[model samples]
Target chain A: MTDTRNLGSQTSLPTKKLKFHKPKIGTAIFLTVWSIYVLIPFVIMFNIATMTPHEALQPFAFGWDEGIQFKAFSELFVDLCMGFTIFGAFLNTLMYSIPPVFIGITVGTMAAYAQSKLTWHGRDFTFGYLMFCWLMPDCVGMGAGYMWFDFLGWTGTPLPFMIPGMFCGVAQVFFLKSFMSTIPNDLLAAAKVDGLGDVMVFWKIVFPLTLPAYWCQIIFAFIGAYNNYLGPLIYLEDPATYSLQLALRFFSVFNKDNKPAVMAGNILAVIPLLIVYLCFQDFILKGINMGSGLKL
Target chain B: MEAENVEALEGVQAEIVERQRKRRKTVKIIKQDIIGWLMGGWPFIGAMIFGFIPSIIGYVLPFMELHTFDYSQMEFVGFKNFEWLLFNERSMFWLALKNSLYYTVSVPIYLGIALFVAVQLDKHIKGTGAFRVIMFLPTFVSSVAMSIFWQFMFDKTGGFNSILGLFGVAPIDFLDDELWFMPSVIFTGTWGACANSVLFQAALANVDISMKEAARIDGATERQTFWKITFPMISPTTFFQMLTSLVGALQVFTSLQLMARTDTGPNGAAVSVVLYMYNMAYQWTGPDYGLGMAGACGLMYQTVLVILTLIIFKTKKRWVHDND
Candidate 1:
């Protein structure tokens, strides 16, 4: 437990332990003003999504004379989105996102363990290489990314995303390495003396110690994969291959100027992500929102 | 003769023991290497293949003059592609270059605001956690959705303008005006700035309260204590946040595209290096000589980033407050 307490500082949790005192009205005022700025967009989104099409002309009115209508939500499912529904888009997004992250998590844990626990001749050099890999192919031009992947016979395929995302998770490895390194080396040495091999030590001791860290990376990976737009836009031009983001983008374009429906589709597109966040908020919110740095 | 034979046998046995030890060391080296490779090497290879190979290809392709992306027919053209990007009237490279820098200019401002807000939130204020959640909500929402919402807000008769109109100010077409388009994009960025505040919140928590108490006991004023101690304490994380966000800001794509709700904003004001690269590759249907050109411009942008990052790192010792 003492070993795991370092997790708090390593990831930098700034909650619960800190003492608090009564703040003045100025703190209340400033926080409220900022909170409005943060949350007003969500309010506007919900307003537009539930508004009648006529009232949507004044989308920011925040009034509902005809009351809130769920019609746009239904219509978004039925006739909006060209031919695809939000659920289908969600599935397509899952196909593109979830598997790579699941695989990346396991791979990242192993890589992180090896990085922090193992000794090899060029281990630090390998760490440097992984950090270099973290520079990522984001700098790859859309045309060049396409052409390069096409040259490899992977253009218009999921392989481009899956291949890179699953393996090029050096950021997660770097993050998890920080967590894994905090586990005392003496524990592993003692385990080894008791006949536990590296693999067994990892499985029996290191993994459980670092389990919470995995969820953090997994959430990061899932959101990253879910929100990926340009990758699919360049590689998956076919409507069938579109990720949720690409699908919503094209859905609005394909549908004939139905503002409320588009707004509703936007709302639907964000639901699963919000659910994922809420589910993992306990662990992640504690950890300084590593997300703010990793992506944001 | 008997004594000499015994000594020779003992020497032979010692040599055999040495050989066995050498073989065991060799086996141990191979085993450790194998374990390292098994755990981490495969993913490292995948990273190299998918990351470095494409990047190197992208780097090399720009120097060739090929109508098709095909390499066999590509003729080496030196810097012709770069010359086109710089000199071509039709190219939007300069606008993208300008816009990329303009977007990054908000980093310090937001980070400053974040640090200030973090100090306030670090107090035992009720709902600070809730405030943090609200601030980070934008991260969960896709940029597409955020853009669409902001697009309406920045509309001529939309939320912001209407509020302005109540004060008798005339409406400005934020998305269509070149002056306002980039500003509107920057405005959308303000909402996302809260994300950094969350990070700073953690950084503030990690600062040494004891140091602050010591400063106060020494008769330091609150502001003086903050500037002299707390600020320096958080400077490393601040530097880190600045580095990562600058990289992210340079790659700002979705907002510029989706907010203006155009392929390019008014008079190409919203075009980013990545967006322009997308245009060169995807928009024209003919032979993709533009592909190489896209590669050229992208390389220029990355080179600038690399240089800029190196410069920032070089300057780190001056401001980053290493806790030695």
Candidate 2:
């Protein structure tokens, strides 16, 4: 494991060890204020989520007065003539998001494995083409995608959102390719010599070796899919098919009278991602470092 | 004589086995090549269909005067769409373009704040890890959620204004006022500044400690040591961060869309180019497909501009230190 706790201590200076160095008072004060600024929204969101609507409208105060109204959390599950419940939107989000990420990872890994390990005609050309495509602004393709989807009568369906994701994601492919490149070609050659098929070699050797890359891609894919508002907004007209983002937006807009419920829904929308980030913070940080380092 | 013959026979058999193994290896190589093709081909086809083909279509779209997705109806209009976008009295394109470019001002602000905090955290202060997590927490939240949360905070009777009221100042209409709208957007834009700082922190950590020690031993103060040694060492990372952040800022849509709530806020003051494109394509009064396509073409030009800027910046690699 990286010495994340002692990041500054990696220096060779014996006298300037991180553990021994006392941080200046100015630095401490700045960090404290910054942290408060960063965290206050979340604290207030949760705090307001536990309050009644009337109390929520009041200037932000901490703690529960009437024993933390769990009503909004429960009420989110109960459909309020808003065409769909929060639970249903969550499920729709999962349905729309999961398949694409699954396909993206699989296709991205396969392509990366091929580009990194296997020799094939046009491999370099294909890699270059994909990189170019990746660098192109998303808007460049989005208009055409909208037209294409409309042409195909796939506009109202989840096909528009899922189909693109089922393809190789550029970032995932690049990250995994770089990771896979680090694994010696000799190991793969040995595996082939052992009578293992290409698929078996990938599953047994290459895939296992690139688990960190996969973890990073998976987390990113999940977050991207979950937080996707633009996709669902453009594609889906049915409220039942709306992702949590759309649903939350709709709820907040129409149900302006209920602040606590809106806050509760916001918290619900945020918690899963928060948990994923908290759990895999190390991998995420390492992945970012690896990405930046690769650019360098 | 019989023993010698037996040894020669065994040698012949061993050679035959080795030749067979070599033949099998060549066949396996062919098979692996086929597998590689199959593995790479699927995504290549997908990219062609979804990525390249659509981009080409989008590029061609602005030149055509088509009301709908029907290609049969498309009339080649030449530079008319471009002319309309540039010179038309009703076009919001210029305003959107200006606002979008203005949004990039936040990139340096974000980077500066992030770098400062990162330097502070790099000092190995107590509970820096906790501070790091707290700071980065906002980044993981959805843009919509963050916008909504900020909407509450920026409300006239909201917590932010209430606090200002305590200080005997009039409540600022952050979202409503044209003057304050961009600032509000920029302020909310900085909520996830810590994400960049995390990357900066990592870069700072990986800076050559020996150089820092040399500077310190030579009587360089902490600030000087940082400015002279550490900053130059991490300039490459700073460049990367700035590039990505600029790209992201130019594509600023979600926060503006959600915060502004409807129609780009107070005479389109907060209208980003992407948001403008989205509205043109999806939510405009008549859904002018040509105009939408023109907006997309505009976005492409902006992207090209960004890439060119990046290429220019990349030429400054002479200033970037390679620690390795």
Clashing pairs in 1: none
lDDT of 1 by residue, B58-89 (tens): 88878977665566777888999899889888
Residue runs of model 1 more than 4 Å from their true location after superposition: A1-23, A79-83, A135-138, A289-296, B68-73, B285-289
The lDDT per prediction is 0.76, 0.79
lDDT of 2 by residue, B1-324 (tens): 999999999999999999999999898877866888789766778888876666677777777776654568777877777777778788787898899888888989999999998999998877887888777776689988888788888988788898898889898888899888988989997888876787888889888787776555545578887887789878878877777677778888887889895687987897887887777766764535444454445555556666765685678666565655
Residue by residue across A129-160, what tens digits does model 2's lDDT show? Answer: 88876665566545667876777789888888
- Which residue pairs collide, candidate 2? none
List TM-score (chain A only) for every prediction. Answer: 0.83, 0.87
Fraction of native Cα contacts reproduced by each candidate: 0.48, 0.51
Give candidate 2 misplaced runs (Cα > 4 Å). A1-23, A58-67, A290-292, B1-30, B68-73, B287-307, B310-314, B322-324
Q: Considering every candidate listed, which one attains the maximal TM-score?
A: 1
